[model samples]
Target: MSAASEAETRFEREDTRRRWLLSTPALLIILVAAVGPLLVVLLYSFLAPGSYGDVRWQFSSDAWFNVFLERDIFDDTLAPAWAHLSIFWRSMKLAFITTLLTLVFGFPTAYFIATRDERTREIWLFLITIPFWTNLLIRTFALQEVIRQEGLLNTLLLKLGLISQPIPMLFTDFAIGLGMTYVYLPLMVLPLYASMERIDFRIVEAGYDLYASRFGVLRRIIVPLVKPGIIAGSILVFIPSLGAYVTPRVLGGGKSMMLGNLIELQFGQGRNWPLGAALSIALMAIVMIALLFYVRNASRGGPTHG
Candidate 1:
């Protein structure tokens, strides 16, 4: 309306345009690198496989159908792919267990760190993150050495006369679970601590002053306040655990297979690129569903933890 108001509006529009221009490079990179490849994969999922490493451009529903059952391409006879479905279910189960284990261990660790003085908290946080300094493969190998029958744990137990023979620890589901927890515990703790750190101590004190029990206060006030972090950390741990290859391979002795291993098999030995692409797309769909749920939950939770 006024000349000065019009000038302010123009300035704001110019600032917005400048911000978009500045972000264009990142947008272009995402389009070309990530989205472009994803589109190619999606296209491949709908097509048939070539004899070698290439894909046939002919449209087919075989890849999608193959996800849950095996079918003869010529005769059209279908059989249940119980093995494939079971692998997916097993991956989900393992991921859920890993998330629960991490939450159980990490909550107290995070709370302790959150309650500490600033310097002490920094030291504890640094200690938690020390594992990241080493290569993951090297760390996994170290774990393998420790858990192997003739390795450190068994040897120490033997010297102490705790057992006549080394206990079977490697190549079991338990070993894979342990590996997942060890790797992903930091991911859980960091988010929980971040959420816990922002909680108002005065509210906690008020709860105590009102004669609320510790558990009561924690459940009613603290837990609600930090629900976002719990969800965020769960997503971080669970999704990665579902797709875990190294832990299942090395620790589970390659006998216990998960979705990641299945996907790798399709691409590597099986040489079925279309099926691999379909599997990848399925994994992506699962992740997107989790994210959508997260977004809906965050919106309902409001600004405090959202």
Candidate 2:
């Protein structure tokens, strides 16, 4: 090789090494701070449960086996863990419903904010984020107050002569879904607003100019353009909704148990650390699958901005 070529290669290698050295602290933090707990949980999931609340040192896949199947203590017959499956299904169903609800509400809210003049837009965005100022638990309790049988909605309806009595709303799947949508709505709105803010409105105008109906313009010109945001918002809302504990706990009143509550039950009252760890891992796997789906869609969607 020529001297110049050799010199350039040597400089590039040094630069790469320097970059790695600079990034070492962040890499180490991620490995130790983040991966350390996960590694512990992974190790715990493979161990036998203690007689009481913790894990034993002995290796066993019984915890994993118990996740999907339960061996009958009497006949040694294996059966599907119907209870666990139900909890898993409920969690996924609630998460999916929450994502859909947030999208339905947030898309218009985002578009509204995006369409506003700059000063007014800032005010609306600020209002959307005001919920973040309160603690999640506090917000959940407020929602609980609103939806509980004797609460605001029923009271107002009763006063307005719209109801014969207080409607039962709390301690149900409906309450759980409502709480999750309320909690995660901002997450959905922000991403959508970001995407919509970058859109070229002239295309929308052109669609209308071409005699496209409002629905047609929205379907063809707007939604396709905000596909990436929609995907991102769904992921943000869905993954967290899957593991949501506080809202479901408060709203469902323990009757409508979710996967998060089930996991907590194993760890806390049930005294099965191995099972809890297994469940934690299962939840992470679901999250990873959602992330992968998002990546696939995002790559396909590409940039939608003008």
Candidate 3:
């Protein structure tokens, strides 16, 4: 080969090597931080419990079997296992509601932002993101205070003679769902914005030129184009909402317990590590199955944004 060609080839090889070397640390960190913990958890899920609530090295499927078979764990007046199942279903419903509410509130706002002037879009986007600057727990607590009987909302309504008594807003499923939607709305918006921003204005204009109604264009073109964003945002909101402990714990009171709370109980007051590990694994399995179903549907739906 000519000297110039040989030099270019050597440079490209060295560049590839340098890039790989640069990426190695991040890859290692991800493996150590994420994969390592998952591996430990998976191992723990298969082991038996020992004295003092330790995991014994003996391999056992008792915990897994109980979870999979939905066998009752506690033989009380209110079966603890049934209670846990009820909590799981309730959490799932709340998560689904939160996801739907976020989508309803976020999609139109994102679409408007995406279609607006750059400066106006930035301002609206900034407004949407402002809430994220504060701690999520603080935001949830703020909502809790606002919804309390003597809090700002009820006080204002009472002064206006809107009601005779302060509404029992706090420690209800409605409050918990509202808290979840408030927290997760931004997550839904950003993805929808990203997806909508990529849509070609030309295609939309073409639809208009072909005498398609605005509603038709939106329903046919925009919605299909934004399906991936919808899926992503739904998954983002739903999964976290499912595993959420604080919002339900605080807003739903003791009555709004979820799988996350159940897991926490196992590790805390319950002192049943094996059972906790089993529950954790079960939760993970459910999430994975749901994610797979989402992926399958999204794939069948045609082209995705990402």
Candidate 4:
């Protein structure tokens, strides 16, 4: 072979080897950490729980079957041989509310930050992220303190003569939803800011130059540009909110028992690994379905004007 052809062949071989070498570590880590555990969970989901809380070698569809067609496990403190589809739907509803609230509050804030002067934007972004630097548990506890009966809010309300007694703010659905929105707001905002910041100013200006109304320009130009961010932020907030344990447990008390809390109870207090595994798999399925929908909608390139 000619030297030129030989060199090209050698370079291609080296490039192939280099690519394989670079990708090996990431592939190995994924196999070991993610895929491996998922396989274990899948196996565990099919097995019966032993007397000592270990998995039995015998296989059973009982877990999956119970999750879909049995008595409501969540109806009482004790395990009923049933599925709690209502609880799943309620968690989804709460997650939806939280997502919408986060979007409503986060969008304008992200827009301003994205469109502002660089240094000022940085400062504002830092301020937005400041809450995240603290531990999430600490933040939730702080919220508990603020919203609890006889807490700061109630104290101020009483001092202002707004009410005769402390409002039932803590241990309510509203409080849990509000706390979730607060916790995930930054996740929504940062993505939105990123999407908005990437939008070309001239496209917006051109819309105005063509005599488009402010609303028209926003509807036609801005929405499409930021749709990805909106979807991303929604998914980010919604999925976690659906499976959230701590915020609801702390803020909602017994009133806002999410699937996460239920699953935890099964694994911990209930000592029902089979049910917990089943519930977890169910939750995972819901999240995956939601993600598929989000991806489908996001990929459609946003809303269209009629």
Which candidate number would show the highest TM-score if scored against the true structure? 1
Clash numbers, per candidate:
0, 0, 0, 5
* Per-model TM-score versus the true fold: 0.94, 0.93, 0.87, 0.87
lDDT of each structure? Answer: 0.90, 0.93, 0.85, 0.86
Clashing pairs in 2: none
Per-residue lDDT tens digits for candidate 1, residues 1-306, read 999999999999999999999999999999999999999999999999888867898998888889879876799888888888898889889989999999999999998999999999999999999999998888998999998999999999999999999999999888898898999999999999989999877899998888889998888887888888888899899889888998889899999789999999988888888999999899888888878988788779554534
lDDT of 3 by residue, 1-306 (tens): 999999999999999999999999999999999889888878887888776777889898866665545543475232235666787788789888999999999999899999998899899999999998998879888998999879999999999999989999999878887888888999999999988889877899998988889998988888888988889888888888889988888888868678899889877877667778888877888799889978997888556445
Task: Give per-residue CA lDDT, model 2, range 1-306, as digits (tens).
Answer: 999999999999999999999999999999999899999999999999998888889999999999999989999999999999999998999899999999999999999999989999999999999999999999999999998889999999999999998989998878887888999999999999999999978899999999999999999889988988899999999999999999989988978788999999999999999999999999999999999988888887576352
lDDT, residue 173, candidate 1: 81
lDDT of 4 by residue, 126-187 (tens): 99999989998899999999999989999999999999988988888778878999999998
Deviation of model 2 at 216, angstroms: 1.1
Clashing pairs in 1: none
Candidate 1 vs 4: which has more lDDT: 1
User: Which one wins on lDDT?
Assistant: 2
